[model samples]
Target: MTKRTLYLFGSAAPPVFDIARVIEEAQARGWDVCLGLTPAAAEWLADGLDGLAALTGHPVRSRYKRPGEPDVWPTADAILVAPATFNTVNAWALGLTDRFVVGVVAEGIGKNIPIAAMPCVNAAYVRHRAFERSVQELREMGVTVLYGEGGFVPNQPGRREPYPWDRALDAVDGLAPAAE
Candidate 1:
């Protein structure tokens, strides 16, 4: 069995080709991909998700704790939170799992599942004291917070070179052997 991977994304960011490319490449290499997005993210851009689901043959999810859903509660080998918004990051860092996105994240963290967050917040919020504290809390909790380039600034739409999808998969592969 291939490793299970969840591609989680936040709301309100332009779509990047790197993400879709990563999913395709990973799947080609025999990884079972799962997708999760914030509610706002669905509103912002969920256009090609059905295509993605067809490619992976797994149900794409936006909610966290729904009972009786056929694909509910699947264990993931890794969780990659891409374009992680400041709101979602802070909420997850501070144990604020009010919504499905955060709730799934909290559950992943609790289970010691490897999580990689590609935060794409504006400069101002990243530099705020509260934001730093929340990030620190996440780091302290063993969550791998991929720091954006230039540290933190207010209003800068982060540099997108190192998306870390492959890196996260490598780490997960190391942590748990892929199912045969």
Candidate 2:
């Protein structure tokens, strides 16, 4: 059986530290995983980036390939952007592609790719008006945003907990079910 490619993008949230394990779990679930990160995330994970590439057998991309450069990763069959920050979510909804992960997911929307996102923001950020509107906009654009009841619920600022990477992957599997 051919493995479906999953573009697992992330932002610079605390949960992003556990991305290696998340990639392993996704692979176990029959996904050919490809890792993408926001610039800050890439820097945060810099020391481990090479190992992550080896784990996924693909480069951990944080920026667009320059003009005339060949694409390294396979075309994604599905996408999951976990630990999506307030900035990433709003930028993506507003079509601001300055960030690589946001850019790919924004374009993925136009390509009709099955995409799911789980935001890892704090309650303080959630209180801002634009956050809800951005979430609504992404949902309206056909991205399955995993938040609230069944997904990520923001904690108080300065508090960190283990992120729900499993829940996000489950949503992705729902979006693109097995042929079996």
Candidate 3:
């Protein structure tokens, strides 16, 4: 059977969130993982881009290619936006596509590709009216917004919580069968 492609999008969050683990686990489950990062996340992970590319056997993408540039990555069977930041969620809800990650996800919704988003925002940020509305909007668009007590619980500002990467993977796993 051909391997399914999973495009994993990330935003700047706690440095402790191990993306390598997420990639490894997805590979173990038979996914060809592709990494996409918001610009800040790309900068934060700049030192490890080479290793990440080697791990996924695909280039780690941050910025959008210029017009006429060839698309390098495989078409995605599903998309997972883990460690999705407050800014990304709001931008996605408002249909902002200045960044590559958000652009792909917004288009993914239109393409009917299964999507799972695990947000990593702080409690204060979650209290913003826009944040809740964004989550609701994404859910209405059929993007699984993994939030609340069982998913990515908002932590106090200035504190880091263990991101539930496994739950994000589970969300994708559940979608994979249907995608096929």
Highest lDDT scorer = 2
| Candidate 3: worst-modelled 10 consecutive residues by lDDT | 171-180
lDDT of 2 by residue, 82-162 (tens): 989999999999999987898899999999999999999999999999999999999999999999989999999999867
- Model 3, 128-160: lDDT tens digits are 999999999999999999999668999899998
Instruction: Work out how many backbone clashes candidate 1 has.
Output: 8
TM-scores vs. true structure, each candidate:
0.77, 0.98, 0.96
Stretches of candidate 2 exceeding 4 Å from the true structure = none
Please identify which of the two predictions, 2 or 3, would achieve the higher TM-score against the true structure.
2
Candidates' C-alpha lDDT: 0.64, 0.94, 0.91
Give the Cα error of residue 4 in candidate 2, in Å.
Answer: 0.3
lDDT for model 3, please: 0.91
Q: Considering summed lDDT, which 10 consecutive residues are worst modelled in model 1? A: 148-157
Clashes of each: 8, 0, 0
- Tens-place lDDT per residue, model 1, 18-94, is 45676677676556667666777765547877876677676556776557655543567777676677788888887
As a TM-score, model 3 comes out at 0.96
RMSD score of candidate 2 (Å) = 0.8
Ranking by TM-score: 2, 3, 1
